[model samples]
Every structure is written in C-alpha cells, then in structure tokens.
Target: MAVSQSSVFSESARGDAALSQINITPLIDVMLVLLIIFMVISPVVGLNLDARLPQANREATAPTVPPLQLVAQADGRYRLDGVVHGLDTLRSALVQSAANDPERVLMVSASADADYQAFANALATAEASGIRQIAHGQ
Candidate 1:
C-alpha cells in the first residue's frame, strides 16, 4: 500500500518580513569593542605631560625683537622673567602684559627635567592672552 502526503503549507504562504528586519548583533559587537577601546585609552590620556627640553647655546645671536622669558622649573614653579608667579595669576598677568604691548612676544623655556606639559600649558595660556609674537627656548 502507498501513503499520501498532506498539503498543510498551501495557504497564502505569508510570514513575517525577515528581510526587512534589522540585525542588531553586529551593532552590539561593534559598540562593545568601542567601549573597551575607550576604557583602555581613557586612563592614559593627559598623563604624560612632561616635555623633553633641548640644549641652548650661550653664544647665539639674539633676534632684533626681545622675547619675554617664561620658565617652568622641575619643581613645578613658574617664573616670569625669573620672578615666581602663582599659576592662578599667570594667565591674567600675561594677558595684561599683552594688552599693554600688543606686539609682545615671549620666550618659553624650561629645564630638561621639568614638566614639559606645564611649559606647553604656559605657552598656550600666553598665546590665548593675545601675545602677538611667541617663541620657544631661551
């Protein structure tokens, strides 16, 4: 005897639109990877702020326009022309100096062992104060 198969799947044949649905698995994976990357990098950022300074010669010809000297010591003290100034007042004082002489320039320098980041910060702060002519080194 032969058996007959039933036609149970012969209706309208419609189902959920699987093709149009979004797959979030890849999205989640990418997001997780990015999260881990950010976690690893967040702590390392802004930590290495010290700059390595270069050697200066005592017998170099000076430029026609003098540059106001700013120094950062290894101990984190900031000096404006060898006079110590607090970090809080440094920016404002530089601004005032720039305002008095709009064409003012500054020489940014620090010891080799000093925090380079501090020197860079000082330079940025001075530039922000509108010192028109800025230079680095002695």
Candidate 2:
C-alpha cells in the first residue's frame, strides 16, 4: 500500500488554516422578520386619531344682528353701545348680550388716550361672557 500525504490528512488538516466565509443566513432571516413586523404594525399605530371633517356649504349667511361695541375711555371707564358702565356691570351686561345672541360679534374700540388696563379688562370680560367673535377697531 502506497501511503501519501493526501491520503493521510484532509484539506483542513493540512495546517493551511485561513478564515472561512461567515454564514449570514440567520442574521438575514432575523432582519427580514423585524422588517415585516414593522410593516404590519406601522399603519395600525398611525390610525389612532378619529376626526370628522367640516363640510363646505355654498349658502353660508352673514349675521343679521349688529355687533356689540365696547369702547375703553381714558378714565378707566368702558362704554357699551354708547352707554357708560362700570367694570362689574359691564360683565353682567356682556353676559346677557352673549346669552341673547350667541352669534353676535363684539367690537372693542380703545381710544388713543385710553388706559391699557381698561382695554384688557374689557377684552377679558367679553371672552368670559362667551362672546366668540371679538374684533379691535380704531
């Protein structure tokens, strides 16, 4: 029998030990599973909010009643519809007006020499009285 090196040792046993190619099938499978899970869950996570959109109407009518007018005077007084009112009475009057016509507009006119505190008070009163639309005028 002829004994040779090829017969005695295999290719890996020949001491030519170099690094082999890495097996990446398991890593690729894990990544693909994660991608699929995210794809399935993304839409469900984004659909959390439910909202009703407003409809557009062609025949929206303007308010028939005139707007409520409040003027701030220099002496810390407020005038509503040309009637001077104290701070306490102004709140009650504004509340009554808002209750009477919920859709009515409020126009606040502050004079050049008016007190800033008075102007702010009148604005706050109107808002607290549930007047939804308030405007500033010259």
Candidate 3:
C-alpha cells in the first residue's frame, strides 16, 4: 500500500510563510473606487469666483487739466489770458489750447456791454469742438 499527501494547511509556520506576501489588489481597488467617486462629484460641485467694479467710494487721483481764461470784450474782440485775439485767431487758439486738455475749465468773462451773442458764440464754439467744463462769469 502507498501513503498520500494532505492539501490542508494548519495555522503554523507553514501558513505564516504563505501569508508573508500581502494581497494589495483589494487596497488598489478601494483607491480606484475613491478616485472615481471624487472625479464624478467634482463636475457637480463647481468653484465660485466674484469680481466687482469700482464703487461710489472709489476716487480717481489723476492729474487735473489747466484752466483756460477767455475774455469776451464789449467791442466783440476776444482775448485769451490778456493777449488780444481777432475772431479767426481766437477760434484757432481755443481749439489748439483746448486740444491739449479737453477737460480744461474754460472761464468766459464777458464785459458788461458785451453782446450776449458774442459770449454764446464762444461757448458754442468751445462746446462744439469737444471742450467741456465751461464756466461763465463777469
């Protein structure tokens, strides 16, 4: 008669050797499941970004434009800062000077006997040529 070998393994030194090699397939599968879970949830949950424009409290600290002194004489002649200017000369001067800074304040000082039309013409001319900030006085 012949003796046969048994396939059963007891919890002893023989089994310990078999258990030494860890089965990491389950750990890797769990990590892959978690990665897929995060990837699927990311699209549903988006990031928020907000940006606002300048408010009423905000102030601009830019260089100011120089003032323009325009005197409308009673005799229908114009003078720019005390310099005598003929009708045509005055218009050209106003346009060139104002071109340097359209925001420059224009102070129109009309004499007591000056025609209202004369002053109006100066103002209209300045305004038509894109000159804003016109101030009138004596």
Q: Which candidate is the best by TM-score?
A: 2
**Candidate 2 segments whose C-alpha is farther than 4 A from its true place:** 1-63
RMSD of 1: 19.4
Top lDDT hit: 2
**Which pairs clash in model 1?**
50-116, 51-116
Question: What TM-score goes with each of the models?
Answer: 0.50, 0.55, 0.51
Q: lDDT scores for all predictions?
A: 0.78, 0.87, 0.78
Please, what are the lDDT tens digits per residue for candidate 2 over residues 75-111? 8888999999988999999999988988888999888
Q: Which ten residues in a row have the lowest lDDT in candidate 2?
A: 12-21
* Deviating ranges (above 4 Å) for candidate 3: 1-60, 63-66
Clashing pairs in 2: none
How does model 3 score by TM-score? 0.51
Between candidates 1 and 2, name the one with more favorable TM-score.
2
Q: After superposition, how far is residue 43 of candidate 1 from its true place, in Å?
A: 75
Q: Is candidate 1 or candidate 3 better by TM-score?
A: 3
TM-score of 2: 0.55
